[model samples]
Each structure stands twice: as structure tokens, then as C-alpha cells.
Target: MELDYVVGQTLAWLRALGIEKDTFVFFTSDNGAARVSDVPVPGGGSNGPFLCGKETTFEGGMREPAVTWWPEHIPAGTVSQQLGTVMDLFSTSLSVAGFSVPDDRLIDGLDLSPVLHNNTLINRPIFYYRGNGIMAVRVGLYKAHYWTWSNSWEEFNQGINFCPGQEVAGVTTHTQQEHTMQPLIFHLGWGPWEKYPISAVTTEYQDALSRITAVVEKHKKGLVPGVPQLNMCDMTWLS
Candidate 1:
């Protein structure tokens, strides 16, 4: 309710300034909810049908709804199923402002103007990273998990279960487990909840794995590691 009120006020202010139609507003959450407890619905937070929540590589943790508003430019009630990431926002904003993204450095974002304007579907691979490690990758309806893990067992011991009753025996775990030799592939078209993983012996699995492997290898070849920021802290100033 507070968020709704704030958004409403922002829109109302734009209208009062006679620039409502000229403004573009994009609203989205950074990640799935941090469901702290196992309480039933309406009591604890929910990440809908997806498994787990924030801090994990599951769809529930990574997937988020994106809402865009542009009164005259973007059509009303238009919906797009294209895969997009928050990084795309940087490129999209520049495109909306009639500017080109700088070419000097590696920009991982793609301009989403085509999708936003015409509702066009752009096929692209989305790589899910947990810190410096690549946890999963999704190309079209198939998602391959190279590493699967959720919150630590310590958290689960404390009665904090992100997945609740939806945990998969061999797939979801508290400790990081590698599936690089045989990635766990899921056809999200049939099961958005990721309840089932395609058998490794199936032709479908072989084909999808081939495609995903190529994309991942190419990405790694050109990747440049960035300096770690999470470990940097200065407490001497306070002392």
C-alpha cells in the first residue's frame, strides 16, 4: 500500500507538471521475496510457484515481474515474454533518450527498445550468477543448472526454509553441488515450478545441453574478472 501510494503520487506529480505522457516509468523488484518463515499463505511472504527465494539461483529467487509505463509510446495492455535482465535497463534508458551506449568497454546489456515498442520476442541466453560462479543459464524455455544450492543448513536448522515443502531430492540442496559434468536441465514450458528435470539420456536433453554448453564456453572465453567489492571495508575511520 505504501509503495502504491508513492507511485501514485509520482504519477500525479508528473501529470501536474504536464509531463505525464512524456515520462517513462519502469517498476520492478530486484529479486524474489526473502521468505523468512514457513508459515502458510497470508502469514509469511511468498515467491509464488517458483522454488526458494532471494539469495538462491532458483527461478523464485531470480525471476521478477517488470512493469513499464509510457502513455503514448508503449501500448496499453501489451505484454512481452522476452527474457530481460536489470542490466538491460541501462541500455533501454539510453535508447529511450535517443542516445547510443558507449562502445569503449564491455557492456553486457542489450537495448530492449524492440521488445518494449513492438512486443517483439528477442531470443537471448540469460546467465544466472551467484557471486563469481555461474550457477545456471537459460536459453529459451530450457534452463540448465550447473550448480544448485540454497540457504545454508545452518539457516535451515534455525527453521528458515526458503523452499519450504518444495525441495527436490537431488537438485536443491543446502551446500553447493556441481552438475557441470551433467547439468540438470528443465523444460520450463511444461513445468515453470521446476518440479521435473529432463532425463540426461533423452535426445532433448542432449540437444539443449549442446546449445547451452556452447553459449557458456563462449561467454567464459571473453570474460574479465572484476575486483571484489563485498570484502572491502574500512572500520579504522570509525575508530
Candidate 2:
């Protein structure tokens, strides 16, 4: 209800400015909810059926729910299930504003015009990063988690801290562990509540993993070795 009120206020402001039809509005969050506002998992917030919470590679951590609006451009009540990431916002907004992205820098985003306008399904692979390292990759509807950790406190609660009528039992949570040599694959489209790994039986799993690996490798090769442009120009850094 609060979010709806905020959305209404935003549309009212746009309408008052007489640019409601010309402007594009996008609503999304950087990551999933936190279990506890200050601490890690099994604390306060909820991600519904998504496994784990923030600070992890699970869909519950990175796969956010979003909404976009563009008056006549984006059809009214059109719901597209296209796969995308927060990184795509840059390129998509640039395209919407009729601006060309600089060619000198390596951009990790793609223009999502086709997907938004025509409801096209693009096979865009998304890489999940935790700090400086990549922990997982998603190609289409399949995700390959190269590294995993017990992302919440509830995982290790063992029914001691669990509230009545909770979906998961206390014994469900587990302690953190190290990464394994083999990756675990999941069909995200089937829902995150089902923690079944499909890679062992599905032939398409290997193909998807291969394609995602190639994408990651390509992006790595394009990286420029240096401090960020913003950091380099800081007066503090020069001294």
C-alpha cells in the first residue's frame, strides 16, 4: 500500500509537469530484502520463496521485482517476463534519451528496447558478483552457482528461533561452508522454493553453462587495468 501511494504521487507529479507522456519511469531495487535490518539472514525481512537473502548469490539476493512505465511507448498493462539486470538500466535509459554510449569504455549493459517494446525474449546472461569475485551466472532461465554459503541465520537456527507458522523449520538453516569445485545448477523459472539441481540430468545445462562462461570470459578480457576515473581525479589521491 505504501509503494502504491508513492507510485501515485510520482505519476501525479509527472502529470502536473505536463511531461507524463514524454517521461519514462522505472521502479526497481538493487537487491533482495535483508533477513535482519542490521544483521544477516533469518532476522526480519522476507524474500518469499526465494532462497537466502542479501549478501549471497541466490536469486533471492539478486533477482529483484521491477515495474516500468512509458505512457504510449510501453503498452498499457503490458507485462514482460524478459530477463535483465540493474546494469541494463544505463544502456536502456541512454537509448530512450537518444544518446550514444561512449565506445572507449567497456559497458556491461545492453539496450533493452526490443525486450520492452516488442516483448522479445533475449538470451542475456547475467553474472552474479560478490565483492570482486563472480559467484554465479544465469543464462536464460538456468543458473549455475559456482560458489554458495549458508546466507541466513535461520538456516542454522535448528528450530530454536523460528516463529510459529513460519514456512521453514529451524533445522532447515545451515552453517556457512566453502565453495565446491563443481557448480550447482537450478532452473529458476521453476521457482526457487524447489532446490532441485537440474544440471546432472539435463543436456541443455552444459550448453547454458558454456555460453555463460564465454560471456564472463569476454567481459574479463575487456577490462582496463587502472583505478576508477572518479578515483583517479580525486584531490586526495593526487596528494
Candidate 3:
């Protein structure tokens, strides 16, 4: 574990630098363990608790691990599940280094120095997106998975053969039904591995045709008028 190893080495380095045990060491990752195969496991990497491989914007693929350490100055033997992002690390390290955000540069990350020093929670608003799709947004305990579009073209964007229940690009776009599918939403607290059509049990599912029609009606001039849009691909977990 990089986190564990870094914790040990930081202590050694602090002593070498004569910084004393009061020196702090911060640790984190770009994202949750969504590594395709960075771990040395026989099969896939250890994104344990999350589902599928990375590149498909999901909880397992996005949420990363974050940590901070200081032998004497920071609280010992404590862990907190604070929801933060990679951008937070820049501001955090800057603060720990006694630096300030530049007046001209724009920043989208939160400063997590308080959490590092006092164990305060910095978990707050967050959003996930893939392409133009606003995949999910987090608000406290409620996580809304919005399927803004519908399954169309049956086939992926290739426009030759239809999707055949295989992972295309990264979106999964296949179902048992012959023609129709539905948008799905899941409560993220449950891990979201078993996402299915909104009405997976029922014969009726939302028609990609209808969804397309609705979009065209809402924005008539911009549905790529007069051209067939059959190559539309829908985003999902299983292809």
C-alpha cells in the first residue's frame, strides 16, 4: 500500500531532515483504487469494493483515497472518511507549506489543511461527469444517477453492427430485450454495482425512440435535422 509505505518513509525522512517528529506528511491518490491493474494481483487490480474497471465514470472509478500524517503534531492512529478530490491536494499542500493561492489562478479544489491537522471533515458537494453527461451528483446522503439519454442505435457508434452485450469504448449498452430500454437510477450508498433498467422486471422500458423524439421536440432545430441519428450510444454499466 503506497499510503502505508509513505507513512513509514516520511517519518524516516523527517528525522533525516532534522524537521523533528512534529513535521507533517500528507498522503492521497488521484482517485479511488480504480487502477486498471496497478496492483500485482493475479487477475485485475484491487479496486475492491468498487465494480468493473476504470474509465467508466462510476463510484468505484472516481472516489479516491486521501490521508495525512504528522508524528507529534498530528493526531495519531485516527482515520476519517472525508470526501475530497485531487484538486484539494494542491491547496492543502500549499497551506501546509505556508503558501497562499495565487490571485490570478483559478482553483476548484478545497483546502483540506484543517482536516489534516484537526481531523475536521471537509466532505462537501461533489459531481461526476462523463462527456456532456452529468453522470451523478452528490448532495449529502442523496446520490442521484441521472440517465439523461436513452439507449439508441442498438449498435454502438460504429453504425455497422449493433451492441452485442460487450463493453464498447467504456459504456455498456446491451439488454435481453429486442428493442426498448429504460433509464436507471440507484442509491449510491448501496455500491451501485447492480444498476439495471428503471423497470428491469417489466416488459415495458423507456424507448430510445421516444427519448430522442422528446429531445427533438424540445430543441427542434438542433437534432441534426434531416440526418439519421441512429449512431447514438447510451451510457451504462453493461454493454
Candidate 4:
């Protein structure tokens, strides 16, 4: 209730300052809002429609909310599903303030001035490597999470085990769930991808899997090429 109250007070202040009209005030959430509000485990309500939230290398952990307000410049009640990144904020603000995006600095994010000024969309890929060897490659509307969480160095083929409901530490409200690269690749729209309900993978879906997996396999090898524990994690599959 404290943060909620602070949010209201902040809004009132902005409204009084008239910055509400000329400023772009953006509010969003990461790793999907907690389903259980605050608890730890696989029991929290998933932001589903996109699998596994927060920790798991699923879409639920990746896609986040984006809401902006700029009464003087941005049209009121405008909801654009334009893709952007939280990492782009600093550069976006600098560019909006008419500053340059320093080429010398290794800016990992892009400038989002286009999204605000020209109402353009961000067209780029975003990747996230999760605990264990699990990782995801997000490109526009298509996202591919590789379930390669491993247990050993020279033996990646043995691979990490897949279980949809495993327990995690620290973060409350997010519970573990089974994750298998095979199931995900074959049925991404379901399970870890959660875009589709069960029993709904069409022929077109199968074809898409073949196409995407081909690319993943090309970039991926069968063994861990780095330090075992530091490079990977133990998800009850291997430690």
C-alpha cells in the first residue's frame, strides 16, 4: 500500500508541475507481475500465455509491460505494442534531450527516441541466458528458448533434466516448472512458450519448429565449452 500511495502522490505532483504534458512518464513491470503477489515457488499465477515467469528461461520471464504518458507530445490513451527494451531507456532519454549516443561507450541498448517521436518500433534481437545452460533468443515476435541447461563439461548430450514444477530460492511467488528443449521446440506455442494451449500445435507450427530449431542447432554445440559450474547451473538435472 505504501508504494501504491507513493505512486498516486507522484502522479499528483507531476500533474501540478505540468510536466505531465511535456514529459514522457513511463511505467512498466518486469518478469510479469507476480501471480501470488509475493511468495516463492511454482504455485504463483503465471503471466501465462507465455510460459514460466521470472527465473525459468521462458517467455513469461522475458516479455514485460510498457506504458507511457506525454500529454503534450504523445496522444492520450495510445497503446502501441511497439517492442522496446528497458536497457534502451538511458540512451533514449539522452537522444530525446538532443544528445548523442556515444559510440565510444558500449551501449547495450538502443535509442527509443524513434518509438516516442516517430512512433516507430524497435526491430532487433534480445537474448537472455538463464541459470544452467538454458537461454533464450528473442527476435521481434518470434522467441526461441534453448533448454540446454547442462550437468557436465564434455557431456552436454546428457543434458539437464526437465521438470515443470521445481522450487527456486530468493524470489518469492515464482515456482519451478518442467522445461525440455525438445518439447519446447516441437510445441513452443504451448508449455514453455505458452502462446498456445495444449493439443493445438498445427502443421504450420511443426514446420516453424523445424525452421527455428535448425538455426539453434547451428549456433549450439553438444558440449559445454566453458567452466562447468560458473558457466552452467544445477537444476536438479546435474550439479
> Best-fitting candidate, measured by lDDT?
1
| Prediction RMSDs, each to the true structure | 2.3, 5.1, 11.4, 9.3
Q: Tell me each candidate's TM-score.
A: 0.93, 0.78, 0.57, 0.61
Q: Whole-model lDDT, candidate 4?
A: 0.54
Candidate 1 weakest ten by summed lDDT: 35-44
C-alpha lDDT (0 to 100) for residue 89 of candidate 1: 91
**Candidate 4 Cα misplacement greater than 4 A, ranges:** 34-42, 45-48, 131-134, 148-239
Better of 2 and 3 by lDDT: 2
- After TM-score superposition, the amount by which residue 9's alpha carbon in candidate 4 deviates from its true location, in angstroms, is 1.5
**Residue-wise C-alpha lDDT for candidate 1, range 57-131, written one tens digit per residue:** 899889999999989999999988889999999999999989999999888889999998989988778999998
Residue-wise C-alpha lDDT for candidate 4, range 1-44, written one tens digit per residue: 99779877888899998777656677777566333223454356
lDDT of 3 by residue, 142-237 (tens): 344443222335432433221122233323443322221333433455535424323435433234334433543443333232334443554343
Report clash pairs, candidate 2.
35-44, 41-153, 155-173, 155-174, 159-170
- Write down the lDDT of every candidate, Cα atoms only: 0.87, 0.70, 0.51, 0.54
For model 4, the run of ten residues with the poorest summed lDDT: 167-176
